[model samples]
Each structure stands twice: as structure tokens, then as C-alpha cells.
Target: MPTDIAFLAIAEAQQLYHWLPAALELARRPGVRVSVLSPSDQLLALVASYDPQGILRPVRLRRPPSRPDSLFRQPSRLATLLLNYATIARFPTLVTTEISSAWLRRVPGFTSHLILIKHGAGDREGGYKKRHADFDLTLVAGEKDRRRMIDRGLCTPEAIAVGGYAKFELKAPRQRYFYNDDPVLLYNPHFDPALSSWVNHGPAILASLESLTGWNVIIAPHTKLARAAAPIVSHAPHIRVDMGSRHSIDMSYTMSADVYLGDVSSQVYEFLLHPRPCIFLNLDHRDGAGDAFAHWRLGQVIDSADALPQALARATGLQPGFVAAQEAAMQESINLSLVPASQRQADLILNFAQTSHPAKS
Candidate 1:
């Protein structure tokens, strides 16, 4: 059956890394039309590189009068933006990596179905919130999310389904950067001002790396951090600061690093894909208890800069002692599959087409 499905990317960077692979997969399916719509030109350009034949139709809308510059700038008002976009788009089914766009189902004039293709496999509390579970259909990566959402009473099994990690299947093998066989650390920090260590312990850690010559560091903070007006600076000869580069979205940093030093971002799951040493910064002063802090069990948690060096040594040591913990965390955090995830996602979308439930007038 011929079907029309649209993949919407509100942000170009992180989402393109997740959605482009699925778009390419769905494009190859017989009698399926896949369209990619994004407000970010950089994201669109990146999508274009993978779509030279124009299989993914591009959709752009004129700014509604007095509309906020971007949905992210004023996220609380996305309903207005989506309402405006509804005038431009009428796809019976719209797929997105953002939960914020679930409002697409609530647009008054249109009765479109929304399927959320979750962006990453992170254990962040917000990612598992009830709001994140709001969608006509939600494609989860593993059993962890499906169970978590059901346990929270957020969404029923009927609405949520497992589709594996689509990005990993599309991921090419990484070419790691090695400097004289030095043990490299990937310092990945979340961009949340209050929850992230970047604004607090990050500069100290970077300065510490500059003074120390023993270890090579990749200061690859969340891409959003680099979007600041200035480039994040790290003058250390052994350190490289990567802020949302095309390479940042790839698995290079995670695979190349021997130890993962991060706070609150789900990329640690990516680093832990092979069960390596990890150190998490607990700037929020959580006691490291309960389901929310399950990831803290995966690595040594440091609260202050005074403990960073010792933590790093233990973190990079041959027997970091956290190996068992790292393994346990990965099992709880990700659902790895032998099946190509993109193919699984395409299958779901195709099945969804046959049984889609668009809102009725």
C-alpha cells in the first residue's frame, strides 16, 4: 500500500543523527513516501547529504505573525507553533523525535497521528517523565523504557512499542583518534545549566587537564553548549574541545575514550556500550539512591573538584572496580539487538500505516 509519513526535526543536530537513518530506511520501503522537515538549515544540509535523490521532501513554513523565533526559544508555547504549522502540513501520520511535537495531535483543524521516535537512550529522569510518554504512538528503544513508562502509569503497552536503537544500526564503525597510545577521556556534559557540570566543575577539570600531561582529553560537551556565541576554549595540547560537530554526533568519541566523564547526558550509555570505566559528576547533590540515580551506580560519583584527580586515576585504571557496575547499568539502560534497528522502525511505521488512528471530525 502507498503511504505518506513525515519525519519532523525541531532541532537539526541531535535529532538528525537519529531521524536521518530511519528516514533513509523508510524511503527504501516499497510504495512509501518519506519527507524530512526541519527549521535548522544546518540540519537540513546534513540531511541533504544523505538524500541526494530528494526522496525526503522538505517542508518549510513562513513564520506566523508575532511567532517566537524558534520553538526551543519559547518551548512552552509550542502549541501555537504547531497550530501554525498545521496550516502548512496535513500528513495523516507525522513522526518526530521530540515529545514536544506530540501537540500535533491536538491541532484543531487537522487530525494527524503522531509517533515519537525517541532520540537517545539516556536514564535522565525527564526522559522518562509522563509528558515524554504523551503520544498516539511512541517507539522505544528497549525493554527498560517500555517497562519504566508502564511502571510509572504514564503510557499503556498498547501505545508503546520497542523498535531498538535505530541510530546504532545506521552507525558506521568509528575511527578512534589515538595520541601516542595515551588513555583518552571523553568529558561529555549535559547543557542544562542547573543539572550540568559544565558551568560548575567543567572549567576546573579542563584547567586540570591543561596542567597534567599524562592523559589525553576530549572535552566534548553536549552540542547545545557549543552553540554559545564563542567557541569553548581548551588550550591544552592534549585536549580537544568538540561542541556539536558532525563528528560529535557519531560514535567516535564514545568508542575512542578509555574512561567516560560526564554528567546527566545519556551518551554515557553509548560509552558503556562495551562496559568501560565511567565517572559521573554529581553537582546536584543527589544521594545516589532510587531509580533516578541508577546511572550513578555505573561509575564513581564525584561531588567536588578536590576528588576529580583521584576519581580520574581510578576511572582510567586497569581495574577501575566499576566494571561490574558499568555492565549492570548497560543492561538496565539499553536494549541492544542483533536486528538492524532501522529496519525494525520501518516495519513498525508500515504496520502503523495499516492501522493508523487519525482523529475523527
Candidate 2:
């Protein structure tokens, strides 16, 4: 007998990278079967690329039907889950990167142990949801999340594992979006209307970028926002706008950028992988002291897009002043270890499965 585990890639494609490595790792071990369930062919194709030997199974889920006249759209998380509830309930253990999967527990006769691998390291309140407590086990990137989740009563210390950042295991070659040696700035805004600076000041910020001399700009908003509208156009030669592309999610911008600009996106933590300059937009003027805005302390938080010029002007000169804080925050936000995060997470899952429900000979 073998333990069965299913990894759900049911959310946005951007989230797949966060948990796929662990799935691949689990598949390699003996006496465990690993399957990846996804509604998108593109996502399944990606899984196949990672598992060239076909050790892991890729199960293409049936998506709910859409209106024939409707434009192409990815199925909503709830819709995907509801449509595939029966298939999902068969597994003894299930792992996913998002919280919506918690809904599966509501299905009649559902008894699978739910595991959550948080996708981002940001300090947004949305990241700490009540539903997190429902998971049998939760995996996070670092102590920052482990502490916060415990403080918020979202999970007990025993139920949570600090698995480092699984997304960091993904390696993408850095791309040069601009030819010159000018500083490249990555403007990655979250898609949440109430929290993202893009919802309010995006166009103004883009317009202002044209006036900034000797700086190359990359406008890569969250994938959700990119899917909502037509691609943004930039007339300025120094500005490169990517609504959402492989480069946006693959760390191409985060790895290559010299300066980071955004509101409440977790990509800032990704950018801090190198401890570069960062300027956050506090356009809505949220409380700086709140736990949700804790990441704001890592950089300059400006209240308006009008300050963009001055911020960029002084970014490099001020970067040295923030290096220590940035490094400390990065360490707190992501636990880097000699062992890859994927391996640690895979090991934890294996231990949990065998102990929770051992297969009888």
C-alpha cells in the first residue's frame, strides 16, 4: 500500500511555481504517489516540463462550462473546486498554495487532511485569514509568518512549519529589459482595489516616469489586474510595460531591477533578495504602524505619486542607509537554508502522511 497525495494547482498560474517543486520532490520518493490537479492545459504542460520522467501524475480537471459568448476567462476558485469535488475527495492528503481550498472540507464525507503552503511573504492582513486555522498543516516561508500566524490565532505552532520559500527554488535567467546602464525600476502593484496603488495612481505614476531621466521602468502589475484589462501602452522609450507575462511572475523583473516601487505587493520581499532600494506608495494613507503595513518600514513610504521624482532621485544615495534593515527583514521573511525548501516541505508532508494514516501491509 502507498500513501496518496494531491497537489492542487487550481488558482492562478503564478501560484503553481510556489508548490510544484515540492510536488516533484514528493513524487521521487518510494511508497508515495503524487498527482497535480489543474484546470488549465498550460499549467499541466508546465508540470510535465518539470517532470520529464513522468514520475508525477498530472490530472487535468474538468472546468465548469462558460457561456459561449463570454470572453475567455479562467474559472473561479470556488467553481473549479465544486466541479471537481468528487475527484479531490479521493486523496488522503491534499496540498495547495491558496486558502480557498479550505472550502473542500465542507463537502459531505470529505476527510482529506488539508495543507496550505502560503504563496507570498507580504504583511497584508488578507494573508492571515481565519480559514488558515482549518488546515491540518500550514507551511510558510519564514519565522515572520510563523510568528504572525500564531499571534493571530490562525494556526498553532505545532501545526505550522517554516519551510523556507518554495518559490525561491524556481530559477529564471535574468533578462535585460533595457540596454543602457541606467537604473531599472520594477513597479509591481498588487491587484486588490482597496490596497493596490495602481487602482488609484497607476496612470499618473506611468505618466510621471517619462520625466525621470536615466531610469528604465518596468510596469508589471499583479496577474489578476493584467487579466482584467487590455495591456498598458507606454510611449516613453525608457519605459517597458508588461501587463502580465512569464517575466512578471518568473522573477525576471525582481532579479534584474535596481529599484523597487509598489504599494503592498509581496514582490518587494522578492526584490529584497538583493537588498536594493525600495519606495512604497502610501497613496491611500493607511496606518503605517499596523501589522498589514509592517513591510513599509523597509523603504521610503511616500503619500503621493507626486513624490516619485524625488524618491527616484535619492534612491541610490539612500539605499546604503536601508541595507541593514532590508537584510534583516528579508532574513525574517524567508528562511534560507543549505537544504532547498522544496525538500524540507516534501519531507514534512511524507512524515505527516505516514504518521497520520499508515498503510497496512
Using TM-score as the measure, which candidate wins? Answer: 2
Collision pairs in model 2: none
Mind giving the per-residue lDDT tens digits that candidate 1 earns over 1-361?
4688888766545666676777888888788888776554555676787788878877654333443443223223274346457543567777888676755545567677777787787776677655665577778777788888888886788888888776775454655565577788888888767677777666676666676557788888777666542567876678888766667877778877888888888888888878888888886587777665678777888887557678777665644577787776666556666777788888887788668766433
Evaluated at residue 277, the lDDT of candidate 2 is: 90
| Cα RMSD (angstroms) for every candidate in the order listed | 3.3, 2.9
Off by over 4 Å in 2: 67-73, 357-361
lDDT of each: 0.72, 0.85
Q: TM-score for model 2? A: 0.94
Instruction: Give per-residue CA lDDT, model 2, range 53-108, as digits (tens).
Output: 99988898887775321112357879989999989888889999989988877776
**Superposition error at 216 for model 1 (Å):** 0.9
Q: What TM-score does prediction 1 earn?
A: 0.87
Best by lDDT: 2
